[model samples]
Target: MLLLELVETTQTVASTRSRLAKVDALAHLLRRLDPAEIPTAVGLLSAKPRQGRVGVGWSTVAAAKEEPAAKPSLTVADLDAGLDRLLATAGTGSGAERAATLRKLMAAATAPEQSFVTGVLLGELRTGALEGVLTDAVARASGRPAGAVRRAAMLSGDLGGTAMLALTGTEAELDAVGLVVGRPVLPMLAATAASPSAAVEATGEASVEHKLDGARIQVHRAGDDVSIFTRNLADVTHRLPEVVQVVRSLPVRDVILDGETLALDEEGVPRPFQETMSRFGADAVRETVLHPWFFDVLHIDGQDLLDEPLSVRIEVLERIAPAHRIPGEVTADPAVAERVSQDALAAGHEGVVVKAVESTYAAGRRGSNWVKVKPVHTYDLVVLACEWGSGRRTGMLSNLHLGALDPTGEFGEPGGYVMVGKTFKGLTDELLRWQTERFQELEVRRTAGTVWTEPVTVVEIAIDGVQQSPRYPGGIALRFARVKRYREDKAPADADTIQTLRALLRP
Candidate 1:
C-alpha cells in the first residue's frame, strides 16, 4: 500500500472523538495492507518505527527546506527503506547528511503526507488509535477474537508481530505463541485505589506486596544465560550486571522473574526514586548499587506459570528467591492490608500493590485484578501562565505553568511565585473554554505558544510526590500533577509554599 493511504487513515482516525469510528477507519486500512507491509504499517500507525529511534530529532525534521511534491509517490516499503538509511548513517557530519535525506523524503511527499510523516518521526502523533484501538482493528480485519489478539500481542510484546500472525497465520499458530524464557512479556500493570483497604476489598482475597520506588525489571534466565528487560521490553542486560549476576546465581534454571530494582543506602533502605534513576542509566563509574526484589515468577524449570493463579506463582517465587522477595502477606482482611501498606511506607518504599490471589497474569492491560494505593499531596498553587493546546485541544488554553509561593525571596523577588512544572491533565472541555476566556483577560504578555498570566488564578493541584529537579528554581518538580479545580476563594499569598512541596520528598 502507498504511504499516503496510511497517512490518510491516521488523519481520519484522529478526526474522530468516538473510539468506534477510529477502529473502523483503522480496520479499513488494515484490510488493504499486504503481509509484507504489516510491520511498517502497524509501526507508523502506533507512532513508532520498526527500526526504532533513527536519531532524527525535531531539528533534523525542521531543517528540511525542500518544497513538498504536489503528488503522492512514496510507498510503505520505500518510506521504511529511507528511514533505514537515516538510521544507518552516523558519526561526524551525519547531521547534514540526515537533514538532506529528510528533505529529499519530505520533498517526495505531499503537504498532508509531510505533516503526517513529521508527526510520526517526531513521536508526536496522538491519533487516539494506538495499541488498544489498533489491536481491535487487527482483530476486526483478521476475523479473530479480540481477546486472542490481545493475549498474543501481550505475550510476544510485539503488536506488529501479532498483527502479522493474526492477519496471515492460523488461529492455532497464534495460540502457540506463548511465554518464552528469553523473550520479554509485557509486564502486567496495576489500577489505582484510594487506599489499601479499598484495593483489598476490590480484589477479594489478595496478596498485598510492597510497591518499591525503583526501576522495574523482568529477568529471564535460561541455563547460564541471563537477560534483563525493562517494563517496556527494552533489553538492558549489559547495563544491569548486578541484576544479571543475581539471576545467574538463582538455584533454579529457566525462569522468568518480574521484580523491581533500586539503589539502597548503607542502612539497606531504598533510596529516593531519582537517586536510583541517576545510576540506572549511568555508566560503570557510578557508586550506587541496585538491589533486585522479585514479586512474581512467570516461568520456572521449563514450565510457564503465566496462566496460573497468583497464589501458585507466589509459591514458586517464595521457594526460589525468599531472601529477595518483596515483603507482603495473603489475607482478605482490610486491616491487614492497611498494615502492609504502612509497613511498606515505613521501610522507605512507595506504597503497596494488592493482587488477587486467584487472578492469572493479564499482560499489557491494566486489569482490575491488581490495584495500587499511594498517598497523594494536594496544594493550592498559582497559575503563572498557560500554553496553546494541540491535537484535540487545539486553539484552547491548556498546559498550565504551575508555580509555588516563594516567600523566602530565594527563587524570585520577595513574594514572586516560581515555576515548577507544566500540566494539562484533568480538564474538561467546559473548563478549557473557561480557562481560555479567563486567562486571556489576565494575560500580562504573550509568546508564540504561551500566555503569561498575572499569577492571580489560584488552582488546587494534586501530585503523587515531588522529585529533585535541575530545571526548576526551587530545585524540585511535581510528579504526576493534575488540576483538581480553580480555587476562586484562595489568594496567591494563601498558596502553598515551595518548602511545603520540597518536604514531600522525605521518606
Candidate 2:
C-alpha cells in the first residue's frame, strides 16, 4: 500500500463526522493491505506508531519543510522504514543530524503525505477516527466480531499486534489472548453520573469506592518483581519505586492490581493532582513520597478475575490487600451510597465511583457499569493556543486557549475543534516555565502574543458550568474555568466534545 493511500484515507476520515463512513473507508483500505503492512498501516491510521517514539520535533519538521515530491511513490513499508530510521537516530546526534534525517524522509513524500507524517510524529493528528472507530474498522475488514477484536486487543494490550492477528490469524487464537502477569491490560474507565445516589441507582447493589484525585495505576506482580503502568500503559516502575515495593509486598504471587497512587502530605492527606503527576516525569524532584491504594484485583494466584464478577474480584482484593484498599462500602441503598460520597468529600477525596456488584471488568471502555460522581464539573479540553504571559508571568506561555471537539461538525468542520474559552488560573510557577519551553516544540503558528499549536495536549479544566455565549463558535463558554491537571494519558480525540458541554445547559 502506498503512503499516499493512507494519507487520503486519513483526510477522508477527518473530512466527515459520520462514524459509519469513517469505518467503511478505513475497512476498505484495511482489506487491501498486505499482511506485512497491517501493523504499520494501523499505526499510521491511529497516529500511534508501533515504534513508540518518532523523536522528530516541530523545529526539525519546520527545517525539513520544502517543495513536496510531484508524484506518489513511497510505499507503507518505505514510510515505516523511514520512521524506524528516525527512531534509531534519536538521542545519538545533534539537532542538525536529526533535522537532516527528517528532511531526507520528508523530501520523498507528497504534500499531504508530509503533513500526515508530521502530524503522526508530533502526536497532533486531527483525524477523528480514534481507537473505537479503528477497532470497528478492523473488525469490519477482518470479518470478525468487534467485541472479539476489542477483547483481544485489551487482553493482549497491543492494538497493533491485535490488528495483525485479526487480519492474518484465526478467531480461536484471538480468543485465547488472556491476562499475563507482565502485560498490562488497559484500565477500565467509568462513566460520569450527576451524583452518587444517581450512580448507585444506575448500578444496583454497588461497591461505592472513594474516587481519589490521583493517578491511575495497574500493577503487575510476578513473585517479587513488580511493574507499574499508568492509565496510558506507559511503564513507570523505575519512577515509582515506592509503589513497586507496596505491590511487591502483597502476599499472593502473580497478581494484577488496579488502583490509584498519589503523593501524600505529612498529614497523610493526598497532595494536589499535579504534584503526584510530576513524579512521573523524568526530571521530577524525588523528595515527595507516593502511596498506592488498591481498589480492584484483576488477577491473583494464576486465576484471571477480569471475567469474574466485581463481587468476586472484591473478595480477592480484600483478602490480598485490605490495608491498602481504598475506603468505600458495598451497599444497595442510594442513601448509603450518598453517605459514602459525602464521607469521601469530607476526607478530601474527589467523590465516589459506584460499581455494579455483578459487573465484570470491561477494559478500555467507558460504560455505565461503573459510574463516577464528582461535585465539580470537569472536562478534558485541548490546548489550541497559548498566549504570552503578562505581569509576573511575562515571557511565559501562561494563558491557555482551550477548545472542545466538534465531532459531528454541528458547530464547525467535521472532526474539527471549536474554541470554547481561555484561562490562566491554576498555573504554578513551575508549570508556567514548563509550558513556555514545551509548547514551543509543538508550535504550528503564532501571533505577536500567542503561539498556536497542534491540538494534541489535553488539560483537565474544572468549570462551574457552561453559559450562553456568542463569542465562541460553540455558542457556550466555560464558567469559572481553571486547569486541574495536564492529562498526558488522554488523546485529543478523547477530550470532551462541545456538544457535551452545551448539553449542560439542559434543565
Candidate 3:
C-alpha cells in the first residue's frame, strides 16, 4: 500500500475522539494492505518501528528539511528498507551518517509524509491508535474475535507478527500460538487502587505481595539456554550475567518467570531506585550487583500456566525459585492485606500489589485482576508552562509543566518556583478546555511547542513519589505525577516547598 494512504488514515484516526471511529478507520486500512505490507503498516500505525530505535533524534529530524514532493512516491517497503539502513550504523561518528541518511529519506517524502515520518522517527505518533486500538482493528479486518487477536499478540509478544497472522492465517492458526519457553511474553500489568484494603476488597481472596521499586524482568529458559528481557521486551541477557546464572540454576529445564531485579545495599535492604537504575540503565557493568526476585511464573516445563489462576502460577513459582519469591500472603481478609502493606514498607520495599487469587495472566494489558496500592503524596505546585496537545487533544493545552516553590532561594530567587517535571495525566476534557483558556490569558510568551506562563496558577498534584534527578534545578523529579485539581483557593506562595519534594527522595 502507498504510504500516503496510511498517512491519510492516520490523520483521520487522530482527528476523531471516538475510539470506535478510530478502530473502524484503521480496520478499513488494514483490510486493504497486501501481505508484505502488513508488518510495516501495523508498526507505523502503532507508532513504533519493528527495527526499534534507529539512532534518529530531534536534531536529525530538524536537519532533514526539504520541499515536499508534488505527488506520492514512497512505498511502505521503501521506508522500511530506509529505516533498516539507518539501523545498521553504530559506535563513533554514527550520528552524522544517521543524520545524512534521515535527510535523504525525508527529502523523498511529501509534506504529510514527512510529518508522519517525523512522528515515527521521534516515536511520538500520538494518533490515539496504539496497540489496544490496533488489536481491535485487526480483529475487525480479519473477522476474528478480538480476544483471540489480543491473546495471540500477547503470547507472541509481537503485534506486527500477530497482525500478519490475523490478516492471513485461520482462527486455528491464531489459537495455535501458545507459550514458547524461550520467548518472552508481555508481563501482566496492575491497576492502581487507593489502598490495600480497597484492592483486597475488589479481589476478594487475593495475594498481597511486595511491589519492588526496581526493573521488571521476564526470564525465558529452554534446556540450558537462558534469556532475560526488559519490560519493553529488550533482551538484556548480556548486561545481567548474574540474572542469567540464577535463571539457569532453576530446577525446571523449560520455564518463564516474571519478576524484578534490583541492587541491594550491605544490610540486604533494597537500595534507592536511582542506585538500582544505575545498575540497570547501562550496558556496561557498575559497582552494584542486582539481585533477582520472582513473583509469578508464566510457563513451567511443557505446561503453559498463563491461562491458570495466579494461585496456581504462584505455586509453580514457589516450588521452582523458592529463594527468589517475593514476600506475600494469601488471604481473604482486608485487614491482613493492610498489614502486608505495612510489612512491605517496613522492609524497605516500595509497596504491596494485591492480586486476585483466581485471575489468569492477562498479558500486554492492565486488567482489574491485579491492583497496586502505593502511598501518594499530594502538593500544591505552580504551573510553569503548558504544551500543545496532539491527536484528539490537538489545538488544546495539554501537558502541564509543574514547578515547586523555592522559598529559600537555594536554586533561584526566593519565592520563585523551580521546574521539576511535566504531566498530562488525570486531566478531563473540561480540565483541558479550562487550561487552554486560562493559560492563554496567563501566557507571557510562546515557543514552537510550549506556552510559557507567569506561574500564577496554583495546582494540586499527586505523585507516586519523588526521585533524585540531575535535570531539575532542585535535584529532584516527580514520579507518576497527575493533576488532582487546580487549587484556586491557594496562592503561589502557599505552594509546597521544593525541600518538601526533595525530602520524599530516598536516602
Candidate 4:
C-alpha cells in the first residue's frame, strides 16, 4: 500500500477515541501493508535521525518555521531518505544547509504527512493504538486469536515477525521462540482490586512481598557482562554501578532478574523516590548510589520460565539471586500478608505486592495475578514549575513543589509541614488555568517566567515515607510523593503536621 494510505488510516484512527474503531482502522491498514515493508515502515515511523547536537537543534528550529506551500508527491522512501540526510548533515554543515534541507523536505510533503512524520519523530503518536492495538488489528484481518499473536510478538519483540507468523503459518518454522532478557519483552498489563479481601478472593492462594518505593529495574546478566534497564527499557547501566556490581557478583550466569532499584538511608530504609531517580541521568551510572532487590527471574541458565508458574520461577530466583534480595516476603496467609503490609508501612516501606502462588509471569500484562496493595493512595502529579509548565504553565510553576499534610507534625518544633519533590503529572487545561491564575496572584518570588506560589493550598498527598533532603525548604523530603486530592475543604493548618510525617520515619 502507498504511504498516504497508511497516513490516511492513521488520521482516521487518531480522530476517533473509540478503541474499537481505532482497532478496525489499524486492522484495515495492516491488511494492506506489505509484510516486507513492515520493518522499514515501523523504523520510518519511529525514526529521529540526528548527526550531532548542533544539527539537531538547527533542524528542530527549521522544522518549526512556517514555509510556503509546494506540490505534494513525496513517497515514504523519499521522506525516510530526507530525514536520514538531515540527521547525517545536522552538525556537519552550516545553519543555511540545515534550514535548506528542512525546507526542501517540508516542501515535498503535504501538511498532514509533515504533521504525522513530526509526531512520529518526536515519539508522541497518541492514537491510543500501540503494539497491542496493532496485534489485535492484525489478528482480526488474518482470523487468528489476539493471544497467539501477542505471545509470539512478546517472545520476539518484533511486530513484523509476529505479523508474518500470524498471517502465514511460519511460527512453527522459526527457531528460538521464547522470551529473552536484555531484549524487550512486552510486560503483562495488570488489573486492579479494590481491597485486600478482594485481592485474596481473586487469587485464592497468594505470596506477598513488600512493595518497595523504588525504581523498576530489569537486570540481564550474561557471564561477566551485565546490563540494567529501567521499566521503560532504557539502558540505565551507568547510573547504577552499585547494582551492576551486585549483579556481576552473582554466582549464576545467563540470567534475567526483575526487581526494584532503591536508594536506602543509613538505617537501610528506602530513601525518597526522587533520590532513587537522581541516581539516573546523563552521568547516573557514573556517580549514583543504588541497590537492587530481585523479585522474579524470567530466564536462568538458558531456561525460559515465562510460561512456568510464579511458584516455580521464585524457587529458581531464590536459588540463584544474591542474599538480602529485598525483604518481608514468603507467606500464604492473608493475615500474615496484612502483618507484612503493616510492618512495611511501620518500617517506612511502601506496601506489599501479593502474587498468586500458581501465577505465571505474564509479560506486559497487569492482571490480578499480582496485586500491589499500598497503605497510602498516590496521585499522578504534574510538574507546576523546575520548579515552568509548558506554554501558559511556563515561568511561575515549572518545578512542581509537592506538599502533604503532617497529621503528626504539631508536636515538633516549628510545628510540622513538609515539601516533597516536584513532579509534573496529571495537568489538564482547567487545572493549569487555576494554578496559573493562583500563582499570578500569590507570587512570592519570580525567576525568568517562574513564580513561586504562596503555600496556601493543602493538597492531600500520599507517599512511601519521609527522608532527609537538602533541596526543599523543609529539611525533610517525601518518598514517592503524589497528589491524592486537592484538600479544598481542609485548611493548610489542618493538613497533616510535621509531627505526623516524622512518625513515619521508622529507621
Model 1 is weakest, by summed lDDT over 10 consecutive residues, at 407-416
TM-score, cand. 2: 0.94
Cα lDDT of model 2 by residue, 1-507, tens digit: 888998899889887778899999999999999999998888777767778557666776887886898998878998788778777774545566767767877888899988887887777766667778899999999999999999999888788889899889999988888889989998888878888888887888999999998888899999998998888888888888888888878788799999998888888888887778777664444988888998899989889888899999998888999999999899999999989999999888999999999999999888899988889998899999999988888899989999998867778766567999999999988889888988987888799999998788999999999999999999998999998889876767678889889888857
How far residue 116's Cα lies from its native spot in candidate 1, in Å, is: 0.7
Q: All candidates: CA RMSD in angstroms? A: 12.3, 2.2, 12.2, 12.1
User: Considering TM-score, which of the candidate structures 2 and 3 is the better prediction for this target?
Assistant: 2
Q: Top TM-score: which candidate number? A: 2
**Which of 1 and 4 is ahead in TM-score?**
1
Model 4, which residues run further than 4 Å from truth?
Answer: 16-21, 43-72, 89-96, 141-145, 164-169, 173-176, 189-197, 282-288, 330-332, 381-395, 398-507
Native-vs-model 3 lDDT? 0.84
Q: Which candidate is the best by lDDT?
A: 2
| Cα error, candidate 3, residue 146 (Å) | 1.4
Tens-place lDDT per residue, model 3, 409-457, is 5676444588889999989998899999988866656898999875768
Model 4 agreement with the true structure over 403-461: per-residue lDDT tens digits: 54332222221212355566555455555666667656544456774565545565556
Model 2 alpha-carbon drift over 4 Å, by segment: 91-93, 282-285, 406-416, 489-494
In angstroms, how far off is 300's CA in candidate 2?
Answer: 1.4
Q: What are the runs in model 3 whose C-alpha is more than 4 Å off?
A: 90-100, 377-507
Per-candidate clashes come to 0, 0, 0, 51
Cα-based RMSD of candidate 1: 12.3
For all predicted structures, in order, the TM-scores are: 0.77, 0.94, 0.76, 0.70
